[model samples]
Target: MEEKKFQPYIPADKVVPEFTVFSVILGALLAVLFGGANAYLGLRVGMTVSASIPAAVISMGVIRFIFKRDSILENNMVQTIGSAGESLAAGAIFTMPALFMWAAEGLCDVPSMVEIGLIALCGGVLGIMMMIPLRSALIVKEHGTLGYPEGKACAEVLMAGEEGGAKASTVFWGLGIAAIYKFVADGLKLFPSEVDYTIDAYKGSGFGVDVLPALAGVGYICGPRISSYMFAGSTIAWFVLMPMIALFGSDLVIYPATMSVAELWADGGTWNLWSKFIRYIGAGALAAGGIISLIKSLPMIVRTFVAAFKDYGKGSAGVLRTEQDISMKVVLVVCLAIAVFMWLFPSIPVSFIGALIVLIFGFFFATVSSRMVGLIGSSNNPVSGMAIATLLIATIILKATGSTGASGMVGAIAIGSVICIIAAIAGDTSQDLKTGFLLGATPKKQQYGELIGVCVSAVAIGAILYLLNAAWGFGSEELGAPQAMMMKMVIEGVMGGEMPWALVFTGVFIAVAIEILGLPVLPVAIGIYLPIHLNAGIMLGGLVRLFVEKRKYASEKEKNDSIQSGILYTSGMIAGEGVVGILLAVFAVLNINTDISGIISLGNIGGLAFFAVLLASIIFFCNKGKKAAKN
Candidate 1:
């Protein structure tokens, strides 16, 4: 945090191997793998975790221990590329799935592989390019001024490269165990992936846990506070809200549901009620949360804008190898070319006006995103709000210009997808640049690494989207795709005005009330949006973190190390489970049989017991290295 008179781990005057073929290839693989994995995770849970730390640990494990290399910059390069995939995946999943969801309802045709790829590529490239001009302004000049917490943590992780094996091994262990666990529970149907219990006495109440590795992993990574907030939100949805709805509207037919509430409860139990009404409230809460964050960030966003233009491109003039960046001229030319291509390209589906909207709004949002993440990390960047805002504006503009109906909706989604990706990728780019600045990595090489990641992930994200859509389909319970659903709702509401306003406004007011009460609105809003079972899984992880952190330790360093190890392990679990989930999706697509496992497997009780073990293992591993650290 002490930025003045700063000295990087690798001094600018000294250079080591970086941007090599080995780094690019390794990083590219991580990018695609994490992209696919996170795409699965996000679509399922309405959230995604950054791949930076996991990529760093894995890079160090392979580069330092396995390959017997000593270059920290090479590891930096690997994460730079690897993490790009995650950021891009985050962007793509948040909005692109709206297209597919709309298609499901017959409002639009399914988006093509080429179309998704083009939008991803253009958005990703623009994000990285936009941040190029702001590197000097945000990362270098305003180092301590903006915490860039994730970036700083990544740097610290890299600086501890000697401990890479233990850390990386924790990740590998989580990955392996989670892969098997996910396969057993979901793939083979050894037990249900989710276990739910309806309280018979409480007519409309139900509770459950997903019992999947990734949800637990997400909970641990987010820690106790945020996780608890999420759980609480889910509680309100499942317990308070659902019961209230049923109690009042038992005989009445809801606006969205064709049947009476009593019929719905009798049919699918409380879940039917949730699917019909609670989700809309959750969506409303989520939109309000996003807008609140954006509103709170407005003054600072303005300052970030003014400060960026004043000091723009100052870092591009350095002759030092580490200080050099992609030439601004080349970046501009390429950005213009991408804009032109998007407008002129047949597969991308953006009209000239849509293209202009993407170009103008994309760059503006990219600028906002880069600096916003510097102030608040990527997790709290209010991207959904940005997407919602863009959709609202773009849809209105399209409607006014005679671009109505399905075609206009498709165009609007295309525009939103690019902007969302750009904003996300830009935030990620800034974070990676910050990491590089601290490590004295060559900005130019890191920029190239980011671009490499974008190119590969761009092509790969489309396939992943297609595969998931083909399997469970978006908006289905198996793959909720929450943010996309919200975007879809907004678009429909605007283009057609058919949104259930009463339910949506209920959620909106709920968010406002929660915000006024001084709680973090977004996490709670997300909890409201998702099912109780999923949030319960995450809550259990949070409780584990609380138990671990609250316990006595031999020393502060030991506690920190143990917590760090738990995080690394959890990151691995999330990725591992996600990869296997995709594999299962393949199975589902092919109609592969898993009845054999069900024949031999235990029922829900076995699942509860295994989940208990899973929880205990997290506590054990969180305390695993404490004695070693002390010794």
Candidate 2:
């Protein structure tokens, strides 16, 4: 018996305005906006938010309210394009900033903007092209099985376009509120965005939260389970490990720390301890988590790849519009062309061997990336861990081939960067395609939209990277760039650079213990890697979600509607804060001091008050959803 076909919201016979100039222009603007914003967030906190839903909501608000247009396809196109910026930025930030860090130490020249653009472009294009062949298998064939949470949520958002700004109000309110909050805390210097208190009784310990709106937004989006795991990791690091070090190694000078534990604690407190010691431990755990995740994903990755090829050309161009994809032959040729380009591109540092590695590893990981996002979501996909795994092997391979010193390290990072972008883009592309599939969008057009986004974002990202570095050095307090730092250390470690090995190994064992205990390693590892304050903020957000969920609902529909509203609201908060963050970076680069706090400074108490109001807003919108559901 034949399986019943899955019908989409827009039927194949239906036609609407899509791929319009307006959509392209809007998408381009959003691509730059979200791309730069995510880059800022990634550099600052070593975390980022997805742009798909935000883009969708904003597009809908404009199309339905501003322009009086009612085309869902056009709105979908905007998000498809806009979201690409975020994915590519994620990949680049995870690896490319290492070059900037290395240059700061005079290990090599600062990566030229052209060099940055070329690398990013190569990765972005390759990620899209590599994942194109898998759309049918991963998206259509595996439909109900995959779920693609964010994609489905995005589709629902587009579906809600008929209701106009009624739904978009949550997003708008969130955007406006968060932007004001960020400007007040960071710009006006009314208060510090990050608030902390040292625990006197618990020496070498502290409790704090970055009072910025985005961290709470992230917690709401990521939810309590993952947030709790991260909080747990941070808890152990700040409360358990730091005090232990202070107690046992009080008089001893650690290898990485020039001063004794007591002196370091006195000098910069627990923060100083974290910078010198906890970072390496976190790096090890992050590396271990990436490998564990990849190892666990191996069978599914292989299955996804095989299934993709087995159904490669099915339902593509020759079939219904809803099923149409770029021609397989075209996808193959473009992929090959990109490979050749990588080899010939001097700035990229890839040889013929390097190009082959790019194609092989690029597609392999792209496959893993797509499948992993399908089962889970893009947020949980550990592209950094994969990059670490790639760098370790790529570095050794490059070293064995006599590419040593600065040249070899650069070459290895180049390889890792492309693969990292490929994985990131692949996951993002899969999500976008899943949304398209559900909404009856043309795969070919969505693919083109993604390409446009990548190209535009690839160009803009270079400038953003340069601007941020000029404002605050990569490893500075303002821009920690943890993933990039990890990438740098991994490459340097392979190349015999100075490092504290014991601490790193201890982190590796910690990750192993986490896995043995059947807990998720990556988030826990990330928690350990980050400052406790940031984790605490995220925990607070998670607590709000817990509150929303714990309440008795009139019905499941009311509950879901309420939760959805909070998600949209928080999504806006992340983007709003991120945009302001990049703006502040721009101000810093221009030597324009935006701080007026000297006159109107709000202390920690005020910052706490603002954060409370921000969380309350999420609940308010959630309650609005309950009302909407009742209606």
Model 1 quality (TM-score):
0.78
lDDT of 2 by residue, 1-631 (tens): 1113888888987988889999999999998887887887788878666778778877887988899898899999999999999899999999999999888888888998988888899899989988887786678767866666567767766775554476656766777798889888988899988888899798989888889887787677667887798899999899998999888999999876778999998999988888788877876787777668768856655675565555554535356777667766677888899889889977777878778888887887787678666644575566886787678778878888888999888888889999999999999999999989988898889999999999999999999999889988899998899889878877887788455778878899999999999998877887887788888998898899999999999999999999988987776676576556666755654568988987887788988998998899899999999999999
Q: Counting only residues 3 or more apart in sequence or on different chains, how many pairs clash (N, Cα, C under 3 Å) in candidate 1?
A: 0
User: In model 2, which regions exceed 4 Å deviation?
Assistant: 1-13, 32-66, 93-113, 132-162, 252-259, 315-333, 356-389, 434-440, 460-490, 578-592, 627-631
Candidate 1, 22-133: lDDT as tens digits: 9999999999987887888789877676777668867888999899998889999999999999889999999999888878788777888988998999999998987787
lDDT of 2: 0.82
Q: Please give the distance, in angstroms, between residue 454's alpha carbon in candidate 2 and its true position after superposition.
A: 1.7
Worst 10 residues of 2 by lDDT: 309-318
Query: lDDT of all predictions, in order shown?
Result: 0.80, 0.82
Error of 2 at 619 (Å): 2.8
